[model samples]
Target: MQFHHHGYVSSDPRVEPAAGVGVNRPDELPDEIDVLIVGTGPAGIVTAAQLSQFPNVTTRIVERRPGRLAIGQADGIQARSVETFQAFGFAERIIAEAYRITEMAFWKPDPNDSSKIVRAARTADDPTGISEFPHLIVNQARVLDYFAEFMANSPTRMRPDYGYVFRGLEIGDGEYPVTVTLEHTAGPNEGATRTVRAKYVVGADGAHSRVRDSIGCTPYGDKANHAWGVMDVLANTDFPDIRTKCAIQSGSGGSILLIPREGGYLFRMYVDLGVVPENDNGSIRKTSIDDIIKQANEILHPYTLDVKNVAWHSVYEVGHRVTDRFDDVPTDEIGSRTPRVFITGDACHTHSAKAGQGMNVSMQDGFNIGWKLGHVLEGRAPESLLATYSAERQVIAQNLIDFDREWSTMMAKRPEEFDSPSELEDFYVKTAEFPAGFMTQYQPSMIIGAANHQNLATGFPVGKRFKSAPAVRVCDANPVQLGHHHRADGRWRVYVFAPDANAAVNNAAIDASTLDDFASWLTTSPESPVVRHTPEGADVDSIIDVKVIYQHDHTRVDLGTVPAIFLPKVGPFALTDHEKVYATDPEVDIFAERGIDRRGAVVVVRPDQYVADVLPLSATAELSAFFAQNLLPQNASARV
Candidate 1:
């Protein structure tokens, strides 16, 4: 939201002034580029959007389809994806158009009449309140549209090159190591083939990814024996919970997972099609729409459905699969060889859609690799940094495969199989965090530091997404979520929590001597990451932004008393940035809520908003060492 520094902006600030590669961008594909992303799905678009933030990094995304996706199969938007949308600056707009899932209704066979199903329990969608953002049900296509829009508005003005199908790719020893072969699917150059070289290539092409095959990576896991018929329809149903999210289990008929869609009259139903016989040869996929509706009515028992229109429908079998690694680097050659080709989303992992994790997890896959690729391509980090993408995300993909397999199995179970009637509901309540996308916790790596000083800020767990808390902006005295301030702009964050204020005097401010000393060390010390990593002549806060949060109330804090590091001069006019200073809201103390030590603490957050490390204010050396492992010094020559 900061603007007008370069010049007075009479137009919308979201539409960044085009520069670099974005200025008069060519319509035809470039012969050489810094990065080439394949596919325009959820994962592909997110990767492009994140890469678009780095104007100097030339990034291009291609799609086989002629244009944007009309209707996406995935519709469930987890809270974690919504939080990511907040960082991308479109959460509010998307939420307004999305259906908020408040509660989930479970139905079981009634004792009085075993044939009929009755409401068993109604549980809150997020009973544990893992995130302030709502669990949404928005079409996957719409979500991609938002990301595509963000890319277009960015300084790079990126847009997907439609009708360009990825043929294959090969890694070489040259500067632009990845030579990608592509075929034009449409336009005057239709049926023509071309080759483009890239420094790094990302494959988001999907389950049958050509890029994955070229890299010698294969997805290995169990194929589903259970089949389900899914349909998005506008219907009139006598079922009481038709408009609500319901998990219905009938005495005779199969179970049904009814999820309300965005529009008031439209909803999606996953009608159980029973177990597929061995050697059936995918015959279950032929289940007709009429058959799906009939099965849905049978599951409802006394109630019936009169379908008016079928929006979209499909038949899919539940399966769990994951690749060994997400990059071209072989297991044994990881450290010695840097990866030039990468894969994400369905290319790396595949799972059931019933858990609503296919698109959500895929988006995270894009985010994980996108930043790493940007850092290396921009010369901000060493080539060794690219190796961590596979090391970190491969484990997360495996974890997701396991969680979805269990959830899908539970959904396919019959009513009699459960030991207790509440087993299904109990499982849903117990494993809420995993489905909501909050269970991911990356292990210690070069990028993620060890939790040696976890006690300093217990609420901000290392390697997990930074949980947002309310605090007051000192300049404007406006309440804001600390985590929401983070944007997907490819800059690391250093949150310096000041010590508690003295209670002896009314409205007494925190002691500034400690903050001053720390600030001096950060700006002047040669070992400081900010001083070592930042390129010559660049803004002080360009690579790593430092902000301060005082323990005193906003009214008691004096802006002039704060250190200059928290208010660095930047932009063409060199205007002082005041947004970095914040104070604990009187009503809601952020320090207490987030368990920050009353004495003092420093939390280092990754560009993706995960808590990388927590240290005391005095641990400047430890902080320097942590970043030294990840970032390359500005003067050092990049391997790429």
Candidate 2:
């Protein structure tokens, strides 16, 4: 809930890092910039924002739109996305303008009397309490504005080339192999086309993506006879759940979903179009706005909706689809690797908007690639890390397609259309995990494949995001949620869960020598990646952010009672300049609550806060190897 207060930058200018920052910028912007983004939507903006941190990596975005959108296309903000947004430093501003979904009402006619409406079921928005942030509804336009603001303030200063049109993309032999052709929408450069090149290209363009077709990432999925109408309106409704989320299944008419939006009397309504008329090619014709509202009125037979004003409305044929390829380095005539060209967001996948997943998953796709692309360009990681973007994200895209197919179908069909009456409700409850965003897990990839990963002490599985727990800061009594610090910065977090200061080791009990074994392993492994990369007198914080987490009774013991590793010396050869320490609250043991033991653990948390891998203190090999796989060595990083 905490917000970082920063002054707004005046005018559009290249955002340079602070004076004498950690690393020097490249002397010149290379002919082939680090990355070229093809759209200014959620995915493109996220890519720009993340790469902003590493100024050495030059990035640019081109959008065909002439101006920023006054209205957005999506509304649902999943918990997982909110947490990631918190890390990016803008969730609070977004939350201030959003309606957090707490619970839902499933309205159907009473079983005994089919004429009277009744609430058949009510459940918590997140029934499992899986995430800290609940499902929220807000104009995706606001989300995009925030992202655009971040771009303006970014060190890269690649404010979108809005009003610019992308003509074509060609990747051939050259330093900046991916060539993007573009033209200005207006101004002195009107009617003139130019070419921009980059080491990597991202196509965040919409489903009718020119990039998808240019790259041959064909969209393949089912598009049934179902059609839907969505609208944001200001109206008067007598339905009891007017201000709240309601799934109304009328006795005679089709289903209508009503959700109250951000300000005033604004609300969103989803009306089932049943079956639309087919076109000459047998494709369904797009429904008209008037027909959509007519159906909405029909669905709410008992309670009337008197529309005072209409904000935006759209009607479309329902369908699910995903591209086969996300990224590729095509072979030359002799079968050599070409430059990197990739596609994300709608360019890669599209599905029914009923789930409110388009914008959330799109931003996440950008989040996943942002850091990996930064690492590759900065020489902190090899090109192999870039491959995980497609590997990790494509699965989520496919899963979303499958989920949308069922959820949209169930919501569109009448109760009698199902084989059995209860089938509709059963399917809704079963696939609840899709929208939560927590269930999306990346399979084993070069970044995640680790040794002895399954035998970790804490049962928090690798590939799953690290779950958060409440605890108080040791320095101050302020309460801190662990996930709050799972920042989007490129650095990885190594949480070394140490024993209580008063707890026992092999030969000693209730003493300061509690972490003798772990400390020895750390200091002795000087040739390890951490020590090897760190300057002779530098702290390891430059390499990775380290924190020691435990559940010790602070009242019973002082800071000196704990091992020195928990309280590392700051001068030189220290883990961090600022003490990297944390502990559980006296009223609750956060570690034990998460099935962690007093013996402690070494949990490797990825930049995205996924529990990447865990190891025993004794297994220095596993720890070293894990870092080596994900991060570039000292000499390799110097190439930046």
Residue 629, model 2, lDDT: 79
Supply the TM-score for candidate 1: 0.97
RMSD of each: 2.9, 4.6
TM-score of each: 0.97, 0.88
Question: For residues 448-488, could you state the per-residue lDDT of candidate 1 as single tens digits?
Answer: 98999999899999999999988999999999988898999
Off by over 4 Å in 2: 1-32, 110-117, 277-286, 329-339, 418-426, 450-459, 501-524, 534-539, 560-579, 635-640
lDDT of 2 by residue, 87-194 (tens): 877888898888888877787766675555667777567776777677888888888887777655556554666667777888876667788787777667788888
In the predicted model 2, the residue pairs found to clash are 72-141
Badly placed stretches (over 4 Å) of model 1 are: 501-512, 635-640
Which candidate wins on lDDT? 1
In candidate 1, position 286 carries an lDDT of: 91
* Best of the candidates, TM-score: 1
